[model samples]
Target: MSRVTLAQWQMLAAVVEHGGFSRAAEAVHKSPSTLNHAVHKLEEQLGVAVLEPVGRQVRLTEAGELLLRRARQLLENADALEDVASRLAEGLEAEIVLAIDQIFPPDALARSLDAFSEAFPHVRVQLHETVLHGGVEMLEDGQVDLLVSGLSARGFLGEPLVTVRFIAVAHPEHALHRLDRELDLRDLEQHRQLVVRDSAQRQSLDSGWLKAEQRWTVSHLDTSIGMLERNLGFAWVPETRIRPALEAGRLKPLPLTAGGVREIPLQIIHRDQDRAGPATRAMAEQLRTSVAACAGTRNFENIE
Candidate 1:
């Protein structure tokens, strides 16, 4: 049972922020006397002189500085609570489930998420990092509100997001580079290849495996990249994912006569676009905006 009220603290803050009751009253559409009485009552309830006369304009006392500083935080939280309540009344979604492919640009994904959280601070996000058809599976099962994938869903239409380039690369010290000649599919088949396993539980794909003599399959692209960096094997990895490694000379691209690179266009699909709430729609918009913004900073080759 507290004696002070949020409205009273709000009045005190208005007075302090405006430097006097007269200005704060005008700013808040309240009379100066009403603002004065609220501040006086607040100080009396707290048993402290929160404001002191400094000849003309009043200033916060030592106790007032600390008390009002804490009260500002409470005020901000109360406003945020009210905002959430209003959004809920307007049918804002409480949570958004998003399934994105592993090949998507990480920078664009991070930027979109940061922007989404800033706009909808209360909405919860469940991010599923899928590979190949995994995102499409989630959309098919109605497990996610939004899906970003290189594969299209059977019944749903998607908007073109971006084109990702995959390059065949191996560590600079790998044995394939020692041959000093342009390698072909036959040369690569003799050595080991690292592949990322499809993440889907059912209807999984083995799209990129080259049927090498020795092959290693892992569940995540990060593991494949790690294996490539350690000179374990070669794989066709996303250019965005391996850009740093390429720039650092830790990995070298294979000098194949042809078919050394592949382009996969990604898409944004909603589980049910007509039924999507505000948060879901906003998340989709942010993803598109992020991809457009990130595209200008990088350059990719058009190797056939």
Candidate 2:
């Protein structure tokens, strides 16, 4: 078995990152000869040439590239172990990554984050705003510490947060508004519909009623709203997002014969509720409070 040490892998990575041995030695506070010796010993132990000379510079061989990739993961896991140890000894975590659905009211999210920042000033926060199926995917992939989503993943329980209302809307002067009658699916199919594409990489989901022959798929709800305002197409947009537009006559609700409005129930999800840390639990509480405030419901216990 090869007796390779973490120090040797770190040295190799530093050399690759900083360009040369001398530079890496300076960066890592080691002598050039020590770094050179470590690399040579590592290659001898592994029985493979890791680095090759390229004129004045050095480059990793194919074997070196593969080993370095694995080394990076090991180093990251080692760092995480230390971080978790420190957090367990203390009461605060180093950082918390949160993923939230796009349809969730932005004002509620902002308020919750603002409160969390004040409460945990020492802890760093990373926020990801995702579209349909995106937040669930992030949670399942273990990329985020917490998730707020409209759809729940199978085998995991989610706490109900709030319900968001969506309404079919278009520019005031659009042909649909000019019709001045309750329109059916056939009428909408003849016009252009603005659709937001699902952000899931493995399984894409189509939401709401979509039967338009001419459709424009966008990556975000804001883009769909913008397109609707410009008379590019009609879309089902969050009521909270288009309130100003509706009052200003920039956009108006479509008089659909059916399926004019949709209410989506959003929930807070954690990978393991039993293992949730203090910061994560606190953030979840803040999210629930913010949603309750937005809904004007004093009885938050009634949620779900």
Candidate 3:
């Protein structure tokens, strides 16, 4: 079998992208005959007809389409390789993938990302907003460079970023709020509880006082909050997220006799601190600073 060259793949990809060999040649700064011959040689080497002539323009055959898809991926990988090499040569990171838990304060996350953008304009950031164990899973699976989550990841030390207070809340006119005396477990169990399902694939877990007889499970924290706002059910939502609603009389904390507010400790976990690049370390520092700026009395701790 003849080995296919990258130059041939590039010519084929260019032809498909520009809709014809002539246009591709013009775009890539090559003559039309050169691109045409390159694609023809590629087809001969692969022992298949890659392009078919229509009325005016040419189209990719079935085999051509399959090869084109793989060719595009290869070209992208090659580009990424070059980008990484260039960044490394310049002592900078090409990209940073960050996975953050949904419970993390939005203002803090936004502030951190804003700082990151300003600090490292050339570095590309891939943000993944996860829930529950999703962030930890991403960290463990090597899918993210850094993780900010409430769940503690095994085999990795984490630094406490902030403490999120979860308040059991419901609409002002909800039955739970209309109760005469302080609410208890029995009262909550009678009402429908809106719970956010853990976004873990392997071992999904539930959290925060889910003892309700009737429960409405959702995928996102916003969905659960929306349900609470509509008086459809009660949920334990982050205090920061419901502050405006609480002040506006749209949502009120359930006056539970025992447990009303639950404080969750969130932490920043990295797969390997030593292996992290300069951009990753800088972004981590920015995230810590952002959380500290918002955290009033919450103390930051490092697990080592």
Candidate 4:
């Protein structure tokens, strides 16, 4: 009861989602022993069992189910109050600075800013373009109130509005492009693969992605697309970015999801307890909806 905080609940939920001590540990980057101890400590305090072990797997108990819902509500309310308190202490007049990941498109932002400006034009909105791989770094620096960015490596939240599929891509004539099924990351070992060095690429491509004899790491997704169009090398990219190309028959996606290939996630982030004022709140709402519009999912699922 006394030690039951938002953190324990987070670990509890992670344990539930992942279904085992080891997997949940990996998901939250905590050790199994640590997670086990914390969960037991929480259960002891609450005087209700939280997990039921079933042949090396763990599922939530009845008490765990009840506590999960209550824990989530508490975490959310605590975050909201923190946001509110910070804004009041700051006089609600502090400018809101936001960092946009370089990979973030201007079109997505145009609509969001339109809604924000229409509602609160006087709240100074300072925008900065973050370089690739810097989304979380910028947030950690406190340089941005919110980050409208692509998938980050780790530590940042994995709030996905859109599931931007990652698939093997190539020009019309490349040997790999003719496949009907999407190519996975491992398939690149045999072909000339071009990989981008941006946030999207970093999120999708890793050591497990490929072991190709010839690989190129370009600075931009478009550049990789350009090389693909030239029949130079195959690469992985967001399907959304190449939807036009696929529609035009200029490129094709190899069918697959094996290897380390995965959809690039988009996230909106502010400090844990940092509250938004009228202007910031208005802008945050618009930003959230705008991301959902781009992503085609109304993900008001996790809004911390």
In candidate 4, what are the lDDT values of residues 1-304, reduced to their tens digit? 4567788888888888899889999999999998999899888888999899998999989888988988889888878678666755766744778777644544457788988876654457888765445556667666677776564534555444443455566787877656655665556678887865544322333422367889887766678788887889877665556667877888876655654245555667664435545666666677667766765432212221
Off by over 4 Å in 2: 1-88, 297-304
Give one digit per residue, the lDDT tens place, for model 1 in 238-284: 99898989999999999999988889999999999999999999999
Task: Name model 1 segments beyond 4 Å from true.
Answer: 299-304
Model 2 TM-score on a 0 to 1 scale: 0.68
Model 1's number of clashes is: 0
TM-score, prediction 1: 0.94
lDDT for each residue of candidate 2 in 1-304, tens digit (9 for 90 to 100): 4399888999999999988999999999999899999999999999999999998779999999999999999888877777767766876667889988888888788889899988776578999888778878888898888888899887678988887888899999999999999998889999998888888888888776467788888898888889998999899887888888987999999998788888889889997878878898889999999887867532222233
lDDT of all predictions, in order shown? Answer: 0.92, 0.85, 0.85, 0.68
- Sort the predicted structures by TM-score, highest score first: 1, 3, 2, 4
User: What's the TM-score of each model vs. the native?
Assistant: 0.94, 0.68, 0.69, 0.53
For the record, the alpha-carbon RMSD of candidate 4 to the native fold, in angstroms, is 21.1
Error of 2 at 253 (Å): 0.4
| Worst-scoring 10-residue span by lDDT in model 3 | 295-304
The stretch of ten residues in a row with the least summed lDDT in candidate 2 is 295-304
Candidate 1 C-alpha error for residue 3, in Å: 2.3
* Candidate 4 Cα lDDT to native: 0.68
lDDT of 2 at 203: 80
What's the candidate order when arranged by decreasing lDDT? 1, 2, 3, 4
